[model samples]
Target: MKYKKYLSILVISVLIVSCAKNPFTGKSTMALVPNSQILPMAFQQYDQFLSENNVVTGTAQANMVKNVGQKISSAAERWLTANGYAGYLKDYRWEYNLVQDETVNAWCMPGGKIVFYTGIMPIAQDEAGVAAIMGHEVAHALANHGQQRMSASQIQQVAAVGLAVGTAGSENAAIYNQAFGVGSNVLGMLPFSRSHESEADKIGLTLMAIAGYDPLIGARLWERMSQQGGDAPQEFLSTHPANQTRIDNIVKWAPDARAVARKFGVTSFKN
Candidate 1:
């Protein structure tokens, strides 16, 4: 009993110590691994990933990708500085690449390493579409979702261990582990991931608007995404929100996003 109490206190202490505020969301998030350590590793892995892929270069599509990336990144920097988080992105070495692949996906690694797969370009359609995707990817990095995810996983593991230790003498120990495995994933990790996706959608919309892209295009882009039509995991089991959900959110939040951009003197947006 004493051991269990100590373990509980330790877990709580670690969570408290590792919490940090996300400037964009103004909410506390776990940061078990500091950016000081994660950034270098992320950069190294990004370089390795680039070396392994066929990076598109000197093409119009490639140029478009780079241009949109820069616009979104600059907008993010402006927002950060204005929000009193100046120098927040100083350590981020931004690199954007278009890779020749048919995955219909794009991702931004920690510290601003971004890649747009060729397959997604067709879906993106134009610079405005690209801005929508770029904004979301950049928002993920700015919000430190990756770091928070890792921290959450670490805490989940610790909790699992604590559960096992606490239930060591139970005849239903195996059953307890089985239940926890399902419950933790459904109740804990999945919600964390889904919330991140939703938050990214809202942030991305505002950033793209501030970067002079029409926020309404975000919904249209997702409409195209939904038309791509593939089997998707159920929303409750998936890490990302459903495409329709995202599309609806973008539409619903367009006016608010534009209002935010107006505060930064960005009233005009591209068609």
Candidate 2:
């Protein structure tokens, strides 16, 4: 009993000490793995992924990807600088690429590596639409969602170990195991992921607006996404919010986004 108590205390201590502040969220987030380790691996993996894929170049759409990435990334830097975090992106080497795939997805790797699928372009439809998506993906990186996810997975593994030891001699061990797997996922991991998506939406809206893109474009982009996403799992069981939920959030938050941009002297926005 004493040993278990000490073990629990040590776990709590580690968790408390492993947190770092995310400037975008103004919250202390888990960082069990440091960026020094994560960034290099991300850069290497990004290079490898591009090498393995058919990356598009020299096209108008490709140019647009790079252009919007620059604008949004610049917007992030400007926000940081104005708010007293001048060198926040010194470690971030921004790169954007367009890949020829029909996956209808775009993602940003840790440290500013981004890829946009050709499949998502039709849905994006214009520069403002692309800014909406770019801002969201960039927010994920700025908020360190990748690092937090890795830390969360580590905590999940630790919990599994504790459960294994606790149930070693129990008659209900199998039932406990099954319940732990499902219960932990539904109660902890899934909600955690959903929150990240929602947070990215809010931060992305602000970033796009600051970059002189209309925040309303975010909702329209998602309406298109919903048409593409015929059916999504229920919110409780899924990693992302439902499309309607996301759209509602964007609609409610658009004015707030514009307010943020107004501080940065952005008086007009592109639709």
Model 1: weakest 10-residue lDDT segment is 2-11
Residue 270 error, candidate 1, Å: 1.2
RMSD of each: 1.7, 1.8
Q: How accurate is candidate 2 locally (lDDT)?
A: 0.93
Estimate the TM-score of every prediction: 0.95, 0.96
lDDT by residue (1-271, candidate 2, tens digit) is 5247436744774756588888899999999889999999999999999999999999999999999999999999999999899998899999999999999999999999999999999999999999999999999999999999999888777777777776677788789878989998999999999999999999999999999999999999999898874667888999999999999999999999999999999999999
For residue 267, give model 1's deviation from the true position in Å. Answer: 2.3
The clash tally of candidate 1 reads: 0
Weakest lDDT window of 10 consecutive positions for candidate 2: 1-10
